[model samples]
Target: MALEQLSALKYGKKTDLSAKLMNIHTKLRRYAAVHSGHANMQTTLCALAVDEDERAFAVNVGDSRMYRCRGGCIRQLSTDQSLVQMLYEQGRITADEKKTHAQKNVIFPVLGNASEEPQPCITEIIGGVQRGDIIIICSDGLSDYITQGEFEEILALPMRLPRRIAKLAEAAIKNGSPDNVSVVGVSMV
Candidate 1:
């Protein structure tokens, strides 16, 4: 459903990206409610859209993340909407503590939350995606096992995007990621 909405939005003008994203969330919520019996099926979503002017817009739900690497440095662009993230944001726990927290995997805002509307974080990169910048979107299975510094190093390598993405997935698997790992890499040319 999300992909269908996104595909429909792709042909339209870029001015209404956020509204389109919200609509997608609403549609997904409706679908989930209609299929409430399959309660175990839930998904984290993170999407990025780059315009012709190099502006980037992102919408994220759950623990999946978006990262931007520029000038040899990497920074996360999406905030994790999980219990541990809330605890860290509230200063109730340190970053290291949150990493090992018992509820690290407890994500409240997801695609199928029937009790409330999913609140996705929307971010706009105003001329921030310059040429040579690398954008990465990944699931928690990869981010949970890989550090930002490690992403920086991997992205900085003089390899093709596919190879770099493969290396990242391989590294996460080697690091004992128990969940499914997925990564998408886009390099601004």
Candidate 2:
């Protein structure tokens, strides 16, 4: 339902995307609060949008992610909202420990209600989206299983956008993904 609302909007500039995302979250939060048995229900989102000048912006909430492949390397464009990620960022935990943390799956900056939980979602401007760059928006199921090197390897192949998405999703499941996998890919031509 949140995804459906996001798909219908226009995106441009940092403020535009920020306000739109917040509005969507606000509306969805109200709906879920009144109708849902689970008051804390939340979901993740990862999106890439292009403006009239062709500038790209990435926005995300929860643990979903957006990645940009440029100059032969893939970079994560979105930050995770999980507690494990926060601990690692603050130097309280190591990279390996982030994976093994007891609350590894506790995600934050949730879309449900920011008033109840005070974490702001992240938004980033994707600089210099070039002809050969690739952008991928995906769920954790895909992001967790696809390593940096493997992503580079698969994306280096001479395949169309749809085929690349297919292979990536397939690889995630083959790698024993514990949750649903979804991927959207675009190779900037």
Candidate 3:
């Protein structure tokens, strides 16, 4: 599977982030098919769009997840596109085992593969943005290593987002990540 992460400042076309994100996904799918050779493999695109004007932020994705830890509440802002998620939705997997299951990372759609036409799953979440709101976009590796509560604790520290991201990578390594770990954390200053 291919992995990608991008965090950019909002200068222009703030309203077009969704379209640009979709375009990136389209290009990624073609690249995956021609090079990665997994045509049938599905793609998952997770994105977070911040709208300072509307005083809100929007999250969209297939498998990648976003989370917010404010005050004492830790909230997950994205959905997983995995068999385990399906099972969880169908009431087959318990809420506690959702992350501990062996197939927790078995995403139904990822970024690459060239065996068949790729289809990407998308999910969106919307909420108001606080001045110190912390937004995280990360691969399953990092997510699997640290629970949402742990992430909240991490964010609570007085550290920069980039440093926090590095800490996340370190945590994943410490937890024995078998796959590459990627993480991007953006905080509204």
Q: Write down the lDDT of every candidate, Cα atoms only.
A: 0.80, 0.79, 0.64
Model 1 poorest 10 in a row by lDDT: 10-19
* Best candidate (score: lDDT): 1
For model 1, the superposed segments whose C-alpha errors exceed 4 Å read: 11-18, 29-41, 51-54
> What's the C-alpha lDDT at position 7 in model 3?
55
Writing each residue's lDDT as its tens digit, candidate 1 over 1-189 gives: 676667667533346765666677677767766786655445678878766766677778889998888898988888899999999999999999987898888887576566666777777865567788888999999998998778888887798999999999999999899989999998888
Give the distance in Å from residue 184's predicted Cα in candidate 1 to where it truly belongs.
0.3
lDDT of 3 at 10: 44
Top TM-score model: 1
For 94-146, candidate 3 gives per-residue lDDT tens digits of 98888789977666644443343334433434566576777777777787778
- Model 2, residue 79: distance off in Å is 0.8
Q: Report the lDDT of model 2 for residue 40.
A: 69
Candidate 3 positional error at 130, Å: 2.0
Write one digit per residue (lDDT tens) for candidate 2, span 1-189. 778888888665544666677777788788877886766667777777777777666767788888899987999888888899989999999988976689988887666664654254545465857898888889888988878888988888787778878999999999889988988888889
Q: Give all TM-scores, in the order shown.
A: 0.86, 0.86, 0.72
